[model samples]
Target: MSRRTAVIALTALAPVSWGSTYAVTTEFLPPDRPLFTGLMRALPAGLALLAITRTLPRGAWWWKSAALGALNIGAFFPLLFLAAYRLPGGVAAVVGSVGPLFVVALAALLLRERPTARALLAAIAAAFGVSLVVLKAGAALDLVGVLAGLASAVSMSAGTVLTKRWGRPEGVGPLVLTGWQLSAGGLLIAPVALLVEGAPPALDGRAIAGYAYLALANTAVAYWLWFRGIERLTATSVTLLGPLSPISAAVIGWAALGQALGPVQLAGMAIAFGATLAGQLPSRGTFSPAERNGQELSVDPRIPAVRR
Candidate 1:
């Protein structure tokens, strides 16, 4: 495969793995400990990456890494877990599906990329399709859960745009950047999890295996791919792939979790998947106006500064 296609496929794996989180949490992990689960998913994986990379942030990056971590991991995780616990079925997924719209607007404002009509429409269609796939006819929504879902979406959206805007420091690979954010975010979650949830719950073999999968596959590696993709692709394209999470969730629910998928859900999946594919199409040229004019745009990090 071409490099761009490979990046897209690898990045797409992040959300696809994330789609299994609900099932893993419900089936194997302890109950009513969203903070702890978030902690487990982030901290160990982060520390592992840090050890492997053996790189530390310098100067401004220390703060930048911390900020990005808070938005993407610390804040996003607990909120996401809260929504999953409180909101039944697809309500949380539907709420979170608005992320692309948030990214589109943020990119326009923060990244100075013009929003394309296709992106706007795809975001709407993806949300609607996800709602159909996951939202039950009368799934009662908790007010707190809805708010949490919205907040998580916003937090992650902001994190994504900021990641794209900042890019990585010279000589810092996505592995190092991923480690920094995960560690920072995990540390942030540690105190709150301790305060709110008290002690960590004892883990059985099932829970241990679940947490291990979450930390390694779902979080550490997945986030590395995600950040890597962000370095190459437009923020809009990256976030648009988020719909796959719910669609994957639904499929897993059917095949693994014994949840049924009716005709409507199938149609919804098709629509959402279609929008996801469409979102990957290039928006104008990848280069910004300044770059096209043979001028450097602000910071030129080690990563190729492609906006699309």
Candidate 2:
């Protein structure tokens, strides 16, 4: 497969990995102190990655990885768990869907990419669709949940952009970058985990399974594939896949969590999904640095690296 296609294919994994967190939290994890759970999810998974790689970045990457880790994994993970704790499953999922929109704005500003009107419309539509799916009349929303979800979106969005702008440096594998961030984020949260929640208690069988999936699959494997894609694709185009997260979340909710969606919710999802696709079309606006800066569509980052 082409690099760009590989990027799309790989990026698609992130949301699916993320989607499983909710089900795992509800079904397996201990039912207390979400921050504690969040910190563990980050620390152990990150440390596990570090153990495997057994390598670290040199020079500027040392700090770059730390910064990226704090923004992407550290802050985002805890906020995510807290939001899930505070809000309804659907509500959290809906708010999380806003990631793509934040990515759009960040891309336009930071990456200097010109967004097609369609992509903008798609981002808006997707946000609206997420609301329809999750929100209902008279639902009481928690301020903390709202802030947490939005914060997760922004932190992740910025990480996505930065990843594109300064992808994995030469000879530095994506796995290393993933490990660095995971470790950094984990260490950052260690104090909080100790102070507020303390170390993880014993795990039940189900919790063990959940931890395995989260640490190995979601953190290690998913991130490996993601940075592999990031190395190959532009951040903006790659982020277009952000909507897949909510779509996968909804599916997991339906299948795993026994959550149900009616016709309106389905329609909203369709419109949201369609709009995202339309925005990425070359006809709307090819996501390239030059195209974003009003220059020209010379290279499409989503193309496979080998092909490029």
Candidate 3:
């Protein structure tokens, strides 16, 4: 297949894997204490990568990496859990759907990507759709959850732009960046996990397996793929795969968690997802799919190629 298609396919895996997080956390991993889960997911993954890279941030890179780690992993994660706990699955999904929309605003400020009218319109519609799907009459919206989702969006968005701007230093690969952020975030959260939660909740075998999957497969490998894809493509284009997270989460909830989606919820998902696709589509006279994916990477439509 073409390189663009391959990039798309590989990028898609990141979110599809992430989609399982909520289900896995609720069903398998320890419950209630959100910070602990976030801590465990990030720490080990970070340490493993650090060992492989043996790379440390020299000079200002130290603070930069730490800020990224905290913003994108440490803070974003627990907030995600809190939102998930407080909001209904679909509602939360729809709420988080605004993430890509938020990226548009951030990108305009950070990446200098000019927002087209179509993108803006679609984004606004997605926002309204989220309001419809999540905000019920007489049911006051959860301010904390809303803030959490918005904060996660901002953190992740900034990370996306900043990662591109910083790029990887010479000899540093995406894996190292992934590892550093994960490790840093993990280290930052460890003490809090100790003082606040103390120990992990009673976890079953399934929980252990789920945690392993989250750390190794979802957090580490998935992020590696994500950075690689982003490197090969534009930030907006690469991150467009984000909608897949909620989509996958919705599917997992339906299939595994047995969480049902109403017609309105489904419509919201459609609009939100549709907006993401529309926003990411490249204009004519850009890199082709094959050109983007080097020979080593086979292009697969099943993978979300974030090709520019």
Candidate 4:
């Protein structure tokens, strides 16, 4: 595969791994410890990456990493777990599917890229498709859970756009970036978890195994791939992949858990998957004259180009 294609596939793995979170959390994790769960998922993974990479954020990156980590992980994780705890998994996933819309808007404001009509439409369709796939008849939604779900989406969307806008410094790899953010986020969560949750929940073999997977594979590997993708792909393109999380969750439910899929859900899957593929296509008529003439497209001067 071409470099770009390989990068895209690797990046896609992040969300696909994330799709398993709802199932894992509900089945294996201790109940009502969102803060502690978030801390465990983040800090260990971050520290591992830091050890592997042997790198630390310098100067301005210290604060920048902290802020980004707070938005993406510290704040986002607890809210996500709260939503997952209160709302049905499908409802929470459906709510989180609105992230692309937030990304589109944030990209315009943060990255100074004008939102395309096609992308906007795809975002809408993806949300609708996810709702069809996951929303069951008589699915009860808690008001706080719904708000938390939406807030999680918005928080991550803002982080995504900002990450794209503030690309990594020269010679810094995505692994280091991932490590920085994860560690920062973990530190942010530590005090909060201690204050709110008091003590860590007791873990059996199954729960320990689940947390291990989340820290190693889901947080470390996944976020590394995600940050790497953000460096290469447009923010909107990255966020468009959010729909796959719900779809993957639904498939896991069907195949592994024996949850039955209805005709409408199947159709919704097709539509959402198609929209994801479409969203990856480069926007037509977006290339500047230089790009049209076979030169590299110019990035916004405000946003630093990521060095490969």
Candidate 5:
């Protein structure tokens, strides 16, 4: 595969692994401890990465890492859990699907990446398709849940855009950057998890295994790939891949959990997948440093330009 294609594939794995979280949580984890679950997913993974990398954020990155941690992990986890608890799963999934739209708008303002009409349409179609895949008719919406879901999407979107805007410090790879954010985010979540959930639940072998998988394969490695992709790809392109999370969830539900997929769900999957591919195609506004500052410079001629 070409370099861009390869990067995209690796990045896609993050969400695909994330899609398995629901099944794992329901089957193996302790009941009704979303905060603790989120904590386990984040803290151990972060600390492990920090131990492995042994690189700490310096100067401005100390706070930068903290800010990113809050947006991407700390705030994101609680808001996401709140929405999932309060809203129907379908409603929550549909709200989260709007993340691409949020990323598109933020990329325009923050990263100076222009938003295309095609990008907007693809975002809308992705949300519609995810709704079809996950949404149930007559599902009720809780306003707080809806707002929390929206906020979570915005938080992650902003995080993605900022990551793209402030490329990692020279000589600092994504692993170190990932370590910083995860540790910061995990630290932020610690007290909240304690306050809300009271204490960590005791874990049996199954739950321990589940948390291990989530911390390692799901959060640490997946986020490493995600941040690495943000370094290489446009923020909009990265966020557009999010539809795969729900689609993967639906597929796993069918295959592993014995949930049925009807014609409408199948159709929705096709549409969403098509939109994801469309989002990857070269468009008018690829990432350009000049676009941000109205400078006359262009991206390096040596680096192959990623299409919008």
Candidate 6:
């Protein structure tokens, strides 16, 4: 495969793996320990990546990594778990599907990339499709859960757009970038997990397996591919892939958990899947006046520069 194709496939794996998180958490993870679960998911995988890469952030990267880590993992994780716990899996998935819209807006404000009409439409269709597939009649929604779900999407969307805007530092690879963010996110979670959650829950063999999978395959490998893709793909394009997570989750629920899917759910899945494919199409026009005139959006200087 071409390098670009390979990168897209790899990046796609991140969300595909993430789609399984709902299942794994509900089945195998210790209950009532969202912060602890987030810590385990991030820190060990990050530390492992650091060991393999043998690279440490220098100068501005320390803080930059911390900030990105906080947005992408540290904050996103606990909130995600909270939503999952309070909301039904479908409700949470539907709420999280709005991430692409958030990314499109943030890209315009943060990266100076005007939102394309096609992308906006795809985002809307994807959200509608996900809602159809996941939202059930009479599903109760908790206010706290809804807020957490929305906050999680915003946090990750901001992180994604900022990642693309800054790019990576010269000579820094995605693995290292993934490591920095994961490590920083993990560290941030560590204190909270202790202070609020008290201690890690005892794990059975099944829970241990679940945690291992999350740390290695889901967080480490998946994030490496994600960062690698962001370096090459437009942030908006990459975020368009967000809908796939819910689709994957829905499929897993149907296939693995034997959750029955009606005709409407199936139709919804098809629409969401189509929207995701449509979102990947290349933008077909010249740069907007703002971009042509070097009016690129600038992030706060306090944010560390990314390697490009």
- The candidate scoring highest on TM-score is 5
Any idea how many clashes model 4 has? Answer: 0
Whole-model lDDT per candidate? 0.89, 0.72, 0.72, 0.84, 0.88, 0.83
- lDDT per residue as tens, model 2, 87-148: 88678877887787787788778666766676677777877877776677676689999899
RMSD to true structure for each model, in Å: 3.5, 4.8, 5.4, 2.9, 4.5, 4.6
Q: In model 5, which range of ten residues has the least summed lDDT?
A: 293-302
The residue pairs that clash in candidate 1, if any, are none
Q: For residues 51-150, could you state the per-residue lDDT of candidate 3 as single tens digits?
A: 8888888877798889888877877776666677777655555666666666667766765666668766666766655555445556445888777766
What is the TM-score (0 to 1) of candidate 6? Answer: 0.89
Which 10-residue span in candidate 6 carries the lowest summed lDDT?
Answer: 292-301
Task: Report lDDT (Cα) of residue 110, candidate 6.
Answer: 79
Clash counts for the predictions, in order: 0, 9, 15, 0, 0, 5
* Tens digit per residue, CA lDDT, model 4, 1-308: 65556667888899889888767887888987878888989999999999999999888898889989998998898888788888997789889899999999998887776899889988998998999899888999799999999999998998898788777766777899999999999998999899988988778999999899999998999999998788667788888887888888889888877888999999999889888877888764334454444443324446432234
What would you estimate as the lDDT of candidate 5?
0.88
TM-score of model 4 (CA atoms): 0.91
lDDT of 4 at 289: 51
| Per-residue C-alpha lDDT of model 1 across residues 1-308, encoded as one tens digit per residue | 65567778999999999999989999999998989999999999999999999999999999999999999999998898888888985788889999999999999898877899999999999999998898888889799999999999999999999999898777778999999999999999999999999999999999999999999999999999999888777899999999999889888999998999999999999999999999988667454565545543333243465432
Q: Which regions of candidate 2 are displaced past 4 Å? A: 1-3, 283-308
**Where does candidate 3 stray beyond 4 Å?**
85-91, 125-139, 284-308
Lowest-scoring 10 consecutive residues by lDDT in candidate 1? 294-303
Q: Model 5: per-residue lDDT, tens digit, 154-183?
A: 999999988887777766778999999988
Select the stronger candidate by TM-score from 2 and 3.
Answer: 2
Error of 5 at 185 (Å): 0.7
> Measured by TM-score, how close is model 5 to the native structure?
0.93
Residue-level lDDT tens digits of model 6 in 46-87 = 999999999999888888899899999999988887888889
Ranking by TM-score: 5, 1, 4, 6, 2, 3
